[model samples]
Target: MRQDKPELRNLSEPVRFKRALALLLMTLVLPGSAQIVAGSKKAGRYAWRVIAGLVAIVVFLVLLSLVWRSGTINLIVSPTTLRIVQVLLILLAVGWAALFVDAYRLGRPLTLERNHRLTASILDGVLVVLVMTVLIWSSTIVSAQRDFVASVFGNGEKSKADKGRYNVLLLGGDSGANRIGVRPDSLTLASIDAETGRTVLIGLPRNMAKVPFPAGTEMAKQFPNGFEWDGCGHDCYLNGVYTWAMGHKQHFPGVKEPGLVATQQAVEGLTGLKVNYYVLIDIAGFQHLLDAVGGITVDVGKKVPIGGIGGPIKGYIKPGKDQHLDGYHAMWFARSRAGASDYERMTRQKCVMTAMLNQLSPQKVLTKFQGIASASKEVVQTNIPSGELGTFTDLALDSKKLPVSSFSPVPPLIKTGDPDFELIRAKVAEAVGKSEALDKGSDDGDGKKSGTPSSVSPTKKPSTPGKTPSKPSTDVDDVAQVCKA
Candidate 1:
């Protein structure tokens, strides 16, 4: 056997203990640091390279997120990128743990006093376990995010912005447990500015009759005069488009979801705006999403009935100022049709949507991302691609500060029994144009009012400038005006 090292045999207990603690501390702060000071320069060089690479990666990501947010999001959602990151994290854990072990070795543990040696061993072991566990946990979350994106967005067709705007159709899909096909109970077209994220919400009543379709599309060819059919005898309302299309998907070949596609066409034709994407929300699963963001605060104008659409009223979400509602109550608040008319329910639904958008923050999303993503995967089906998620994500953040403008083709404006498609389209165009002007005015510090309703001219005053209007809910010029209060 080789002779024992002379330094180890000669060192005092205090000196040895002090040296051991110093090595462990330095290694904990900067891996391979202890080795460079005392042991293998070769291993230390490798660690320094790793540290440099990690620093470079962090800097690059920071810049990327700032300059090209969508690219950053694409990487995060890409399964390939996530898988590579997972492997790298595993390697990093092992290499980092090895450095700690090596740092402890450089301390020459054999020379330490029994108590001091035990203490150093314990600390080094704890650090290794802690660091490894954290990285592994992070890797697991990355996996979860990947799965969530895959399940929710799927491989939907990407749509281009039309006239520098994105028109997305939002439908509240009502598919009963016993129903054959889903019916779109609620309909709203969200026409968003591609660059500014300023939005115009155009609400279409479910009972709107004889909606037109695009000129060359299958829906138009099938019903050239508009969305008309003898089966319902022109009583073929807008909501029935989904059920009708689902029962006849054969006509819509190459379409993954004929019901959704047909509905998109109808909305596009009726509004004269190109539909870029469609989000079909399952009504029953909506509660889970509301709960994930820790509930929302809404002004309940009247007593909202619960469990009364087809049965006895179980309870009431009492009217109050600034009421905070949980998932269950919020869902019922949007769905209940007991004492309220369908149009009233539609307005309430819009209010709920506006409140959620205004209140949901990046901090909340980050903290509750796992829950939100899980609920979203179940609650939503959409044609929005995963690639544009980052762009929309940024837009959503920008929208939180701005107001949302809305228009609904309801009475005092148009007849739902026999809608004026041409007039409706004109109103839609006017609403969008005024919203754009509103955005421009805000930029030039000239515009303060939101998009005016079709009935209200921009020159006309909404209410007294100083006082809040009591019935802002009826006009719905600035959705934030009513929903926020």
Candidate 2:
């Protein structure tokens, strides 16, 4: 009689119902979730490695879904999303830490019952899965950001035509803890012509001052000198203008207020040409990009001394025509400011860009694809629409079929008292051609007033050697006169 009493049913009626309900929900949820959670079983059993693999797979699937669904970038994680994700992760980690501490102290002998071990285990699993899901989503957001950033273009009209012709403003951002603010270490305009498949590069001197910016009160502070602009005196730093434009009212305006957009506008305003796009990359990222591209071969063209602003940073570039450069040294060459003018730096920047473009074969850096993409992701800000990336790639490929000749808008010619902005404006107009130039100025490079030309030659090369070569004269003009002219 003692042994034969039928074994009691395992669960009470209420408990049974609860368990059944939970099981039903799990069956609905966990098939999809567990598949994501379990991942594929591999040979290795390192816990961390397994977790990382699972995370990677999940992120990949999510991103692939976004790409597939949108066919272009339509989903962008707002700045708010990043903050929420970060805060949530940190809070979860803290809560888990507290639980771990409590378990260590109270659950003596690590028995299963007193602390409800099964319950704790379920909580841990659920939290981990939630964390993993969030992390995967976060990573998807980052990838989307990079792909979209690299694909956008600002030249509204140019983009509409589906031509390769685009404008890019390259800003070398100066970031530091104690500095007054971020400044553009370098500023340059890049023009890619789809029909001609030619790339025209122009560099702007950082110290060139008195450029127009919207005053803080005008037209809701349109730009140039609005609330977004943050520089002392009249004109803001070329790079600061971008920071102001994108997220002037807000600290981080996600990617919408990327400096490139404002730069495209400013360049358009100043130069009278529609900029197709813009790219802002930090010095560190630039170095990485250069290294990732196996460095670049540059023809120095003149003696480049490696020292700057009183020699705190030191390196030497010997006088030579062409030399191979690694990442570190190449940066020094491109950013060197010691015993040099902005014009010289501009020259170096163009050289680096040209060399990079010539050697920018995706095949060579396939192994470092992630690094390249990551570097671009962290540092670059642009307006290249994701939809146009394929078209851009095709255009770049087609460009290789044609010859690329390096050219610049003629340096403004000015009298001792007159500034050369109008002259510069004229050169800019000539650079983009009549139909493309935005602000057709009075001077057209030909010593005549209101003249227009297809292009301007800064110097004329002598056909014969040893004869006194004839060329345009560059008379010394005061900085003020040069700026205003």
Candidate 3:
């Protein structure tokens, strides 16, 4: 009987160790399961209830998203909701970690063998780390979304598309401390077809003078003869509209973004397209954004200088077919005007945009989401509402498959200094018509001839004066091809 008793004790030690290990694993899988099996019933019940509530909330959010995606996105992106979610994630991490520790305790780990006890400690450490990592990651994403919402979106009435196309004016400028005010050095109108996602990039020159405003508007009333008013002699240029309007803010009563508003009006009047929204990007901040996305690759057509106008010359980006550019180098590549004209700089900027659109793949975006989100908030400002973001996102994805075409009103096409509005409208109409036909041809599966222009070649230099501009040399053969190289 004495020998049997010792044997039974030995057997019971192994059984206890196995039970403890089982309970710890169960708790790891289902937060309250181990507690219910071995620990206090009351604690297990509370944890189960909390888990159930979280699951219910998630299910409800999913359903809501399916029914009304825009509303759900707006609610999620709201600053208040982001803060609440961040706090909840932190609380969840703490609560989950505590439950894990309790699960280890319920297993009676202290009574196990030395090896078993060490194993339990290791398991406990892993559980805490894994749970906390997920919660913290979610919290960081929420914070980034909040900052993006607050910095980028502005309180502006959303405008409807005109003739099945949404025209968005994109402005890029240097907002450095040395600059007097925001002077939009580069302006491009991204006119996207609502259904087909066909895009036409319309580039406008910065030094273009005599810019007209939409008739019957306050700006038109102020400058009936164009942006060149009585006092504004040489300062009345297309890019100067923003700074000029800002200086005369009293003229635009009850307007929040008078500068952008004025610029939009000017672009709309020039392009003969109704402008729906505007996105302003600070050139300096754009560098940081590029760095966040691991930089971008572009085809450098010519030798571009780096930092010469204001500061000393830093370096030069040598001409190459496929050049990978970091943030600093990329900024100079887009903005440098040392030996190049503004027209050439405009083309380079368009190339940069094309590269970004094509090269910023989904994998890169997901991996570098945090950095990208934070940098975007600093560099970008727009009146695009949070509610419409999903729709635009879908359109942007659709556009990737379609070819992008560009039209610039520079020399050999349309004179920028004294542009003929009628001629500009005709060119815009022709470009849009060709894009629509191409998209239609693609949809019809006509592989032989998809309405794509043979004259469009990215490598062709602009035709000199006296030559017929029937097919200007400064046309994009395939924006995708240029970007991919």
* Tens digits of lDDT, candidate 2, 1-485: 12211321454444433433343233233322222222222311233353466589668757765555332123323333434545554554444333333322222212334335455455545655565566565555455445434443332332543223466667787565544444677777766665444555555655544445323322234643332233454345444565555545453345454455555555555555566666667775567767766777665544556556744645577644447778877887777777765565665666566667667775864455655666666666665655555556655665555433333432444331223556656655454453222223335553331234524332323222211111122321111111110
Badly placed stretches (over 4 Å) of model 2 are 1-164, 213-240, 243-261, 301-307, 405-419, 434-485
User: Tens digits of per-residue lDDT for model 3 on 1-485?
Assistant: 11323433465667877776777678778888887876678888998998999899889888997876556666766678889999999998898888888887766676678998888788888989999999999888888877777777755577787877888899997888988777899899998987767788887888888888899877898888888866775589999999988888998998876889999989988878899988899998899999999888877766788988767888899876668999989888888988778877877787788778778886887678889888988888889886567556656777877777787777776677787877877677666656666555534354312233423323323333222122222343345444343
All candidates' TM-scores?
Answer: 0.88, 0.53, 0.84
Which candidate has the top score in lDDT?
Answer: 1
How does candidate 3 score on lDDT?
Answer: 0.77
Better of 1 and 3 by TM-score: 1
Where's the lowest-lDDT run of ten residues in candidate 3? 464-473
Candidate 1 RMSD to the real structure: 4.1
In angstroms, give how far residue 480 of model 3 lies from its true place.
Answer: 1.8
**Clash count of each predicted structure:** 0, 25, 1
User: lDDT of each structure?
Assistant: 0.79, 0.49, 0.77
C-alpha lDDT (0 to 100) for residue 420 of candidate 1: 81
Once fitted onto the true fold, the runs of candidate 1 whose alpha carbons sit more than 4 angstroms away are 1-11, 231-235, 441-476
